[model samples]
Target chain A: MAIFYILLLFIITAAIIAVETKNLLSAVICVGAIGFGASLMFLFLRAPDIAITQIVVEVLGLIILIRVCISRELTFISGPREFFAVVVSVVIIFAIFLAGIKVLETLPAFGTPIFAEVPDAASQTYVEEGLRKTGAANLVASVILDFRAYDTLGEATVLFTAIIGATVILRKKTKKLLEEPDV
Target chain B: MKGMTIIVKIISGWVKVLIFLFGIYIILFGHLTPGGGFAGGVILASCYVLLMLAFGREFVEENLPLPLASKLDCVGALAFAVIAILGLVLGGSFFINFLYQKYLPGEALNLISAGTIPLSNLAIGLKVATSLFLVILVLSMFRPDMSGDKKE
Candidate 1:
């Protein structure tokens, strides 16, 4: 759709601004804008759950980024070698993008349920039986919490582990602060 | 970090309560709505972050305290584990809908009819909200400049 294409363009532009900006604060703000644009795209795709999650996660991530940026000096200078590296990376990324487009051309058009001559059996089943099996009106919630509960548990465990790791790593600084007197 | 201006503080004072209530609503209605534990939890954490920004670290510490948040984080995880374990004990499977047939007897789309789902959402919301707040609180404690750093 034209609207989707416009949203995609906005996201791309925001991403470019985020990457190209010299000011860390502006870059962070641009990244947040890109996230908002992408969440809008998710909404356009009929995924309100993902859109909500994306927006909230983006805001939290932006807060952390701003906190980090506030503590550190902002300027980042690139050497010739770094510029060369960027060029190489951009070329490699373009190559991959072209390959992806070729591959996509071989597949069915977007939003058409049939894929590779086979029906979308998994989604069809979830759509048909999700409400009856889970007794939750929100199919996305039922799918994540009921049918895919194990995956959700694993994700929760992963989050817990990340927090634990952060705590352990940061605990040392606090302990060192407590043990030492004022300099 | 120092607190923000007086206008910002006064506005955040009023807004934070509404944010907390909205987060609770999102968590409670997760089963029938778009939002779930993770989104609601992040919103709740944002409330704490807002308080920290508006009222300074000392004020937030006086109200919530880091130790209490860490304890709540552990409790949330433990509660989630207990819910899953209960399923295993009663239904013979991990994270099964054990309470569906027994307690939550109502028509679909009702708030009280989602079996263990609402309970799981509550546990997860608590865990996520507390853990995220703890992360931000700890990060805020670490000053980049040791010479200028002041421990509260």
Candidate 2:
């Protein structure tokens, strides 16, 4: 568990360096690696749901970044002194840690037996009738798709919106093709 | 083109195949394991990155046609929606596990069970693969042509 934190810090450091680096392509690849490392840390913390979500979202973000770089010829140019960057990053990390610790102190133990008291009547019913009624191997899938399906549908619609948004932003300049008078 | 070392070529080939095999394994055992459709899909897309590194963008684009890939993505998304629709028609809630309850037998950890989990994984696998491939392909197409550079 301690090692997971170490890995997380290391990944964060790598991501910072990647963002500050002068090469766009290397930064993109490093960002992807950082996402993978953070996901590994999430798994170590026994939060598979968060890990999966992080992986998917991070990958999507990276793909978008890479596309932007390729289309715009955007290569990062390293600026300013290294000391300043390090100082700023350290302050940011410390502030985040302080905020996170404060937040953590206020929350109840998520995985303890105490939290289990909240009767999952809906989840239990699904587990009981899922196989016979829905035939899903994993109960979460049944819950997401069957019981709480409207939420999933809403999420899918959100994803569709993002896709449309990305498509609109990345739309190629058709004037270049049209103006080139019949090749 | 300059000839590469034999070791580089062998390692590249091995990495791609390993990632591909591991990805398929994850998709197949998605119900029983830590990974599922999304993870498997990303793993599968990584093989193309390996291909891009070893053989370049042209090889990837040639192997994975853009129009065909997008169509596969559409099909996979439709499959996901259709399964939910089927549940609705069967008098179950949208994306219900009606088939799972009827078909699956034995314990929770068993492979033969999980009803539509496997199907969902397959659908997601296709969607992930096609969409990621399209993204990479489209991006690579716009990469600056650096053919005239001298060896560093």
Candidate 3:
């Protein structure tokens, strides 16, 4: 629809502004707008699951970004070269967008999923037999949690490792630890 | 730092309970709904973030200590692995639906269905929610502007 194109244009414009803005807070807000716009695109594509995740992630990331930006000591130095580079990049991006606009129609149509096109596919099996096979009404949940649970385990491990790394790096030293130096 | 205004605090307090319940609902009904572990977990963590912003770090930390959160994070991830290992032991394969194949085979479209999936959802929800909360809590501690208020 025309409205979808308008939303896409708005997101692209926000990304450009976010990149170019000198004010760090304003730049962060613009980036947040771009993320929300993408989430809207997700909803338009009939993926409420991804849209919910994206919107939550955007809000949390924006909070962290704004908090860090406001509290940190920062300095900015710019030159004319940066401006020229920005202009060149913007023009190139716009040119690509204009060219790619025509190619969009060649892609798969919406609402007609790959499972419908291909018989005996893995996802088609999931869609057709998921409820009885896994006893999960939501096929997506069944696929991820039952048929592909090893992958879920890996994801959980990765999250655990990441959180552990963050905790170790950001941990504040205790007074006792600071008082004693190991030779 | 001191929390924002009384108005913000009151409103956040009222909303936080609803947000927590909503997150649990999403996680619990993941087998029958659009939302699952990750989305629900993030929403649950955001509830803590709301409390942190409205009541300051000290109050929020007192309510849910960092050590407990870290332990819960470990437990959630560990639980996921345990579920997989149990599948291998009981069903002769990794990550098999041993529950539905044998025990607790409820009717279709019921809450009790979905063998290991609901368990996985609960585990992942716990892990993600605690991990996110821990990340934000630790990050907030690095706020240089708020250091001055700690001595008060």
Candidate 4:
């Protein structure tokens, strides 16, 4: 327990260093390390699934940050703007932490698994008899892919739109490139 | 070109193999593990990025052209939609695995028993990897001319 607090302190310090740093590349690295530390904390909290997802997403975020850092346009800094941003972020973080701790303390502890509270009605029937009815082996997968399939389709469409938007932006850049001739 | 070191080459090769194997493991075991299609696919792309960093973008672009990667992206997405369509045509809901009982046989908890779930994961993995590679390649290929910018 003490070790966890120590790790949290170290992570918070690292994050502050990252936010205050002038060098973009080193700041990005520090941020990535902080993300990794948060994932470790999640794992310690017995949520390996969340930890894995966090690690994968943060790694990709770091890669994107590194790519952006390499661009010459990202070199400039605005001191006052950055300082205010930090202050706002710190206030928000502290408020969230306090609220979260309060909420955690008030929550009733179910000695058994939390899912036991879910009455055996619609959801239970779906999980157990879904295979027989829907011919899917995995109930959760069936629920996600089959039962809630429309949501999946909607998600895919959102991704497609984002891709199109990105392509549009990139195409404009390519057009600008082609317009210029080397003297 | 002259700054090539033996240590870097050895490490790059090892990283390549590790990334490939890790990606495959993550995608294959996604049903029973913490990983899924998106995670596995990003890992696969990271390998290419790592290779590009250690060697150069030329090595990657030569091996996997932008056009081919784009094609892969389209095909993967089409394959995913087709799978969902198959379920819908069978009078089941879209993306439903209504045909698993006949062909696939295993316990529900087993890794391979998820039927179309695994297939969808593979599709998503392919789509993500190809699209990400294309994005990176296009970004790297751009050479912004400062002289032209100054005139504008």
RMSD of each: 3.6, 6.1, 4.3, 5.1
Which has the higher lDDT value, candidate number 1 or candidate number 2? 1
Q: Candidate 2's residue-wise lDDT over A1-183, tens digit each? A: 578669978898888888777898888889888988988888888767558757865766686677567634446565667898889998999999999999988767645543345586555667677655544565555565556766655654564455445444444632221122344
Would you list the C-alpha lDDT of every candidate in the order shown?
0.84, 0.67, 0.86, 0.71
- Point out the worst 10-residue segment of candidate 4 chain B by lDDT: B139-148
Candidate 4's DockQ is 0.34
lDDT of 1 by residue, A125-183 (tens): 77888888778898888888877888878877898899878877777557642232343
The CAPRI category of model 1 is: medium
Off by over 4 Å in 3: A73-77, A80-112, A172-183, B145-152
TM-score of chain B of each: 0.93, 0.84, 0.94, 0.86
Q: Give the winner by lDDT.
A: 3
Task: Give a tens-digit lDDT track for model 3, residues B1-152.
Answer: 58899999999989999999999999999889888999999999999999999999989988888778878888998888899899999989988999999998989998998788999999999999999998898888766535655546
Which CAPRI level is candidate 4? acceptable
The candidate with the higher DockQ, 1 or 2, is: 1
Structural similarity of chain A in candidate 2, as TM-score: 0.62
Tens-digit lDDT string for candidate 1 (B30-134): 999999898899899999999997888889888887777878988988888898899999978988888885666567989887788888899889999998988
List TM-score per model, in order.
Answer: 0.90, 0.69, 0.86, 0.75
Ranking by DockQ: 3, 1, 4, 2
**Candidate 4 Cα deviation (angstroms), residue B10:** 3.6
> What is the per-residue lDDT of model 4 for residues B1-152, given as tens digits with 9 covering 90 to 100?
42247788779888799888998787776666667666778788878877776777778867876667777888878888998898778736666675574556556667767567777778877887777766666665553533357569
- Interface RMSD (Å), every candidate: 3.2, 5.1, 3.8, 4.6
The 10-residue segment with the lowest total lDDT in model 3 chain B: B142-151
Return the lDDT, model 2, position B85: 85
